[model samples]
Target: MKSVTVKNLIDLFKLEVLIGNEHIGRVITRSRAHRPGLEFVGYFDFFPMERVQVLGKKEINYLHKLTEEERNHHIGNIVKYHPPCFVVAANQEGLKYLMKYCEQEGIPLLRTAEPTTEFINKLDMYLIQALAPEMAIHGVCVNVSGIGILLRGKSGIGKSETAHTLIHRGHRLVADDVVTLKKLGPNTLLGTHNESTREFLALRSIGLVNVVRLYGRKAFQEQSRIVLDIELTHWKDQALNNDLELEPKFSDYLDVRIPYIEIQLQPGRDVASLIEAAANNWYLKQQGYSAAEEFMKRLQNE
Candidate 1:
């Protein structure tokens, strides 16, 4: 997940800074004077400390009625407890005090002319994301004409080798060895490899080589929308999760579901050919034509 700071919040909506410059917290407040999580919309708790704080119109209207002392008490209590970075609201209609409070307390204050609904919508979406879990696996990801394909397997499983072969066959590479996945939204996943891992493919006997230098730039993609996942594992004593046969299932990490496929590896199994066929098969299933399903239906009819 992207750590949302006050600056990030301001940048997100193109809002002007109004007050509170020194405040920082994980929760983005929709109202300055109200307690955290009191906002009806876009209120989230249990977020990282670097998360952005936001304030909306309803809370601002509520703050307008309080006396100076009461407002001060409320803001003071919030600063003492939560210490939010930004107090975002819709417009500056009745929120002149927000600037004053930020100046006095060194907390950042931001205002967006955009309506409360739109502001909340954007912030909520930007804030809600699942980061890729830290893992050490040798793999390669490719965005072949906008299709996100991840190749996974054990060491010496020909993962990187197959990726190189696929690239030779006119496919675009996204990442190699380690893939960082981020759930941008429901059913939308973005995959990126670490800077250190970019374009570095490991060959069984040759060691690590710079693919970008050799493949001329088309061998690396910083990011791509993940559409499919393929895992290569040695033929071993393990069971495949049957749920993958129903709805494309993935291991849930940080509240995100990634579509995954597990392929067992053995000698003489052409990994590159399998990958290509997997992509084509995935595409067919995505378009509502499943050969397996068709065969099953035919058998039942007969």
Candidate 2:
């Protein structure tokens, strides 16, 4: 797993660094945050002290009600575990004790003006994405008709060319040669381009072309939720499956299944147009309309 640090979180959410800059380099592997509700009363059993510790307004106010000696003692016990960081949400008061203990233990102390629930939600989402399982594959991802489609096949199968044509047709290219897919959730996969070559598209005849330069910013997207996988199977001796196409196919990634299909690539085939239709058709199916199923029902009625 690549390193996701406290400093990255600070920069992402614009959190205030109150103390322990040296400890900002701590790695955060846990996606869930720990609120010190139990630890405030000295309950350490089953306490997930390794995750980001968030002290909300209620927790802060509870501590403020305690004596100085008691407050410092409880915070003292909590910070000794040296969690990744202590985030004070809602910019609530009564942080002097927490600051004191965290500074002594060399833990990063962060402050956010956002309310407790909202800030935690944002932080949790970021953590999930940063820590999600990731894989890189050789393909071109594109956003067509509000659907994220991954075009995958062997080299010279026109995956890039189709993506290029789609871009010309007003679709946006996510990645060209290499696309990184992260499992953001059980059913969600985010397809994004590599940072270095995000804007460059490789064509066998024309060489590398900058998508932004050729098609402007609208023609390139940072990331998208991959909803479909189109495998361009070359029409090499393999007969197309007409009957199987009605039920749809599936491809699995990181234990999650995505709607998959095979488009036989023959000479003089308008593969780009087929892909655009595929995107639109998939959207309609999601809205409870399947053309094949509907047509079959009409035949049965007749």
Candidate 3:
């Protein structure tokens, strides 16, 4: 966290300072950051919270009616609160006194041409996300067989449907559609569904449905380690480029490189069976056995 002075803020975002030149040295930063960006836009309304005030043309006009001493007391209370910043919208007429006070206190004064509502709305949106928890991308995630499986697809043939079938097979569901993946540490990547919309699947005929209730609670997982990655793609008659090694290669998603497989989907294909076999195949491979490779070797020997 850091703080920016009024002079710096005036330079950045190029906002005009209508009042308070003395307060140019005030600092601003993240909530806990001792040094804050005075120019920093926050998600919350820091002005009211810090006892800083907003003055538009209307407020300025009303303030003009107060006696000189009353206005001084009001302004004094504001300065005593030690608010780092003050924002004024379209009050150039009343800026002289405010600017003079700001200069003495070293407080930052900000003025914007944009309407008050628009300015606050835009600032809030920017600050909220900037301060929110940060997540890192790892790999796509899917839940299968009570285990979360990360699946990748070029665009869309049947990634969603494959997940649907896995759900119907009594396998618990974790995520659907776009999945957010994060790396927890070395060799461990976590995957989950979109925050706004997860545990839901979209079908061409039926549209969207809740996976948890329709399938069961066991089908939904809040988080899962991305242990395996299966890619669904259009089937090819004969791959011109096949790996001679007949061994699977790994790919990097985020920082983790995961063992991946490409499953080609075609009409009349039992995708569920293929996925299950793929998972089992991976399991067997980890156990130092290859059923498909062994079957090929036996046929060749015959």
Best by TM-score: 2
Please provide TM-scores, in order, for all candidate models, with all chains considered together.
Answer: 0.61, 0.90, 0.50
For residue 290, model 1's alpha carbon misses the true position, in angstroms, by 2.0
Against the true structure, candidate 1 has what lDDT?
A: 0.65
Of the candidates numbered 2 and 3, which has the greater TM-score value? 2
Off by over 4 Å in 2: 42-46, 244-247
Question: Candidate 1, residues 1-302: lDDT per residue as tens digits?
Answer: 22445666666568776654444333443322232444323334543333345566556766777788767766655554345565466565666666676677677777777776666666665555322233333467887655788787776677877888887777777777787776565666677777787777777788888777887887677788777778878786556454424456675533556577777777787777777877887788779998768878898999
Backbone clashes, each candidate: 20, 0, 34
Model 2 per-residue lDDT at 263: 90
> What's the distance in Å from true for residue 236, model 1?
8.8
Error of 2 at 177 (Å): 0.4
lDDT for each residue of candidate 2 in 35-125, tens digit (9 for 90 to 100)? 9898878789898877999889888888989998998888888888889998999987657767788888899999999999998998888
TM-score of 2: 0.90
The alpha-carbon lDDT assigned to residue 248 of candidate 2 equals 60
Stretches of model 1 off by over 4 angstroms after superposition: 1-4, 7-16, 24-83, 87-95, 104-106, 111-126, 130-138, 182-190, 203-219, 224-229, 233-269, 296-302
Prediction 3 global C-alpha lDDT:
0.62
